[model samples]
Target: MEESKPVSYYIPNPDDDPTNERITRITNKIKIEDLIERSKRIKGCKVFQLEGRFVNLFNEAYQAYILGMDYTTVSLCALASERLCYDLIESSKITFDGRIISNIEKESFYRIPFSELVFFSKSIGLLPDKVAGKMMKLNNMRNVYIHPSFKRDRSDPEKLQIKPESDSVTALNNLIDIISGFGK
Candidate 1:
């Protein structure tokens, strides 16, 4: 006669099966430790302007970095950079002689591209020059990471477009600098 297998082998039932319950408990404990480590690694990071979306993205980006998800860290940093630029632009205004310049409508906000947002933020003194420049570079890196056309054009076509780990660290540092400069 065949021995009976735990239900968790086929269909996990953590609530009923002792094996699944143990697994759930172990995974939860591991997650707690991981979260503590990740939090320590990102202790220097703070919410950007107290915006919930920006805060979430920044935390996720740092978590990716801590987890060794290099590419994801870079991509998330780029996304967070874009969000900060957009927020700055949305809240800022240029007034000349009592005229409200740089009127940006909420509905038409997404129409503005990432590059333009970065430029506008820097041009209007809403974003620091260093932050803008780094953000642009990070954005470019993220794009290259996304579409590796250079590899296709290469004679050997074997080398990757970017050095994943090093580039990710650079991207994260650039993003951290930007946040440190602008974040609350």
Candidate 2:
């Protein structure tokens, strides 16, 4: 008779897997470490030179996150990502108004609001819809933190408003991913 297969060979249902949390935590830690290392390497590399500020911003954001300043980190990272994305678009050799991008034209593009920039980038295929969407979300988050009027929505007048810590980390990670691609 053929030997029977062991019961342990079966794949566990993803929903019921008990080790998923631990695995996810470990994966996130590795990703953070990789990001930190990449940030350091980016400073000295030619390909990354033009976009170094974005990397620096991410590094600062990562440090802020490590220090429990998640809100500031997220806001700063979002701003950095916006600048990096705009820089990429301005430098992509894309033509506008029947002319190649000029320094003066780039400056004009920079003056456009973040929402309009995102829209323009998306329309020109400079940014994927998903990335553009995340940029918009991060911009909204930044606006919420930067503009005082946004906080008026709180039902309680006395309690201190606190954003979830994970949101900041996730936002920073998404921004980093978006910025990291610009150099290529």
Candidate 3:
């Protein structure tokens, strides 16, 4: 009978292992710094993206104004206005829930009103009544947008000659100024 050879199994040593404590410590140190730097870069990118998005929204609102599309113009203006309000609240370190000013926390003092977000801005001393009035007009335009029947004549595709009121540009520009002030 032939003698059978015994197989030897390889066992890794924990202490002298290449992937052991020493390497782990070095890797962890590098990972920590790398994670922090990555976080900072991400934050910077987020700020840039947010600014770009805000600018684009503003530009679209302006273009809608030029095109005399009242509903579209006001809709874009309201969205950009709301974004500006939220950004202001965030930068001010004010704690509130909701992604939009219209949906802010119900229990907080900073709670925004569904119909009078401009009042919240006034309460915060960020805007005067004159400025708030512009927002109110935009709010009215928002209502007009939501309730299409209120201005059905303008909505008719065949009524292409129907033009939005001249005041639309003024209202949008006022909103832009109000929001831009917050960034400064």
Best by TM-score: 1
lDDT of 1 by residue, 84-174 (tens): 7766656666565787555554435568788887787688788878888989988888887787463423555654456767776787888
Q: How high is the lDDT of residue 107 in model 1?
A: 30
Order of models, best TM-score first? 1, 2, 3
Q: Is candidate 1 or candidate 3 better by TM-score?
A: 1
TM-score of each: 0.66, 0.62, 0.46
Off by over 4 Å in 3: 1-53, 67-69, 95-111, 148-167, 176-184
Q: Evaluate all candidate structures by whole-model CA lDDT and list the values in order.
A: 0.71, 0.68, 0.55
Could you tell me which residue pairs clash in candidate 1? Answer: none
Q: In model 1, how large is the Cα lDDT of residue 113? A: 82
Worst 10 residues of 2 by lDDT: 38-47
Local distance difference test, candidate 2: 0.68
Residue runs of model 2 more than 4 Å from their true location after superposition? 1-52, 151-164, 177-184
Clashing pairs in 2: none
In candidate 2, how many Å is residue 158 off? 8.4
What's the true lDDT of residue 180 in model 2? 51
Winner of 2 and 3 under lDDT? 2
